[model samples]
Target: MERPYWVSLTSGYDRNEVLTDLMRQYGDDVWNFAFFLTRRFDAADDICQEVFIMAFKGLYSFRGESSVKSWLLTIARNKSLNYLKSAFIRKVTLLDKVIPRERASPSAEAVMFDRLESAELWDHVMQLPRKLKEVIILDYHYGMAIKEIAAMLQLSEGTVKSRMFRAKQRMSELLKEEREYGI
Candidate 1:
């Protein structure tokens, strides 16, 4: 029997079923990556949707130059970075209006306490400088090989290795600080 049209497209054809399969195969992973990148649940949800839409639209450009995972991730990374850049700009603009608060509402305090206790140690991963954060997330969190990370980031293997070393050192310092403060 002939393969279904959607099956052929998701397997690399011009078929709608391919899009559904792609979503089923990658939706969760992409969402996780977006969540890690944005650190905001709502923004991550939006970016995840946008990433898949962009991927589906550009499906025809998948010239077999890279694996489907890599291609999808490239799109996601670009979209997320653009969002971060815009958010940074907005943060800069709103700096005068934003103020740190010491007192929290009861609900806010509870939420904060819960996050403090329940958050993973590595949740601090996002607090690192972007350069170090990238290496740590790609190497340790995502479990990408050093060479693979190097290629993905367009850096030399030695450079990625050095960045990983610095990221580890910074992470250790951050963890120690967290422990000392009981956070």
Candidate 2:
């Protein structure tokens, strides 16, 4: 197969070319990950933009220790978690659940249906704690290897494996319970 566009352009490229390549290549993965972490479409949109903007601003400082994707994900993860923790967002999130937003045209129903299809297990995966959920997503959803997940989460390989095991076990139990009790 031919080498990808960004592979040749990894070094000594103009900022726009490099940034554009990175965004074009990894934009969906980063956005999906942000959405996985936050479960909010609007937050994912903001976090995706912030991830690329932060990547562009810090491009020069990138040491290439891990893959560029890993670095971008680390940034995305932090920004998403920070957004979740902000006091304003906490209140807004509560209000959002309690009070419905204005009924706009249903422009995003397609995206919602696609996401809901994956949660067809009745959102059992979504019920996993964030750490467990993220490992499952990175492993099963994104197909990252355990080593990569460990590095991204700053955990040891053993820890990543254990979490994966726990996530799988919990997911199985959740599914089993649902089947047995229709919960």
Candidate 3:
């Protein structure tokens, strides 16, 4: 009988084995979520690496309070937000040194977004108050269910749903303005 390739590849694996397997299985989806959130390939890569590092380090604390995917997503979201904040601070610090002008035009590949429009959509998303941005990113960008989002964000499901409704409505208006303005 043939052994499973994974069995041969690693030895004495425990529950941590499940994490490695899940990473292999859902890596692309997770990275895509990070990419949409960060709007930069390099930032997504960094966030994904950090997520895995965290998952590995914190594996011993797993309490099964939430699904692994949800837990991982919460980590990813926090990391991405931190990165954005750090980047924003750096930009602010350097604002005087850099020319204040429009950002460089997008590369041809950057113009192609699988969802909504360009990464500029995230600019509008960032413009939203934190509560709205959190809900929108969890529901729309991460494809999390309202119940899951409520659990993750510690809000009631009804609140999650309502916030999601308002987020989509506001996002619709923002997107329309973006299109009209060609931004």
Q: Tens-digit lDDT track for model 3 on 105-129?
A: 7543355453546567777887786
* Cα lDDT listed for each candidate: 0.69, 0.82, 0.72
| Model 2 residue 46 lDDT score | 93
On lDDT, the candidate that comes out on top is: 2
Q: Which regions of candidate 2 fall more than 4 Å away from where they truly are? A: 1-12, 102-118
Can you list the residue pairs that collide in candidate 1? 6-17, 9-13, 10-18
Candidate 3 residue-pair clash tally: 0
Instruction: Give a tens-digit lDDT track for model 1, residues 89-146.
Output: 4684366358633434444323643677535655677788777887887776567788
* Candidate closest to the true structure, highest TM-score: 2
C-alpha TM-scores of all predictions: 0.72, 0.86, 0.64
Candidate 1 deviation (Cα RMSD):
6.0
Rate residue 75 of model 1 by lDDT: 70
- The lDDT ranking, best first, is 2, 3, 1
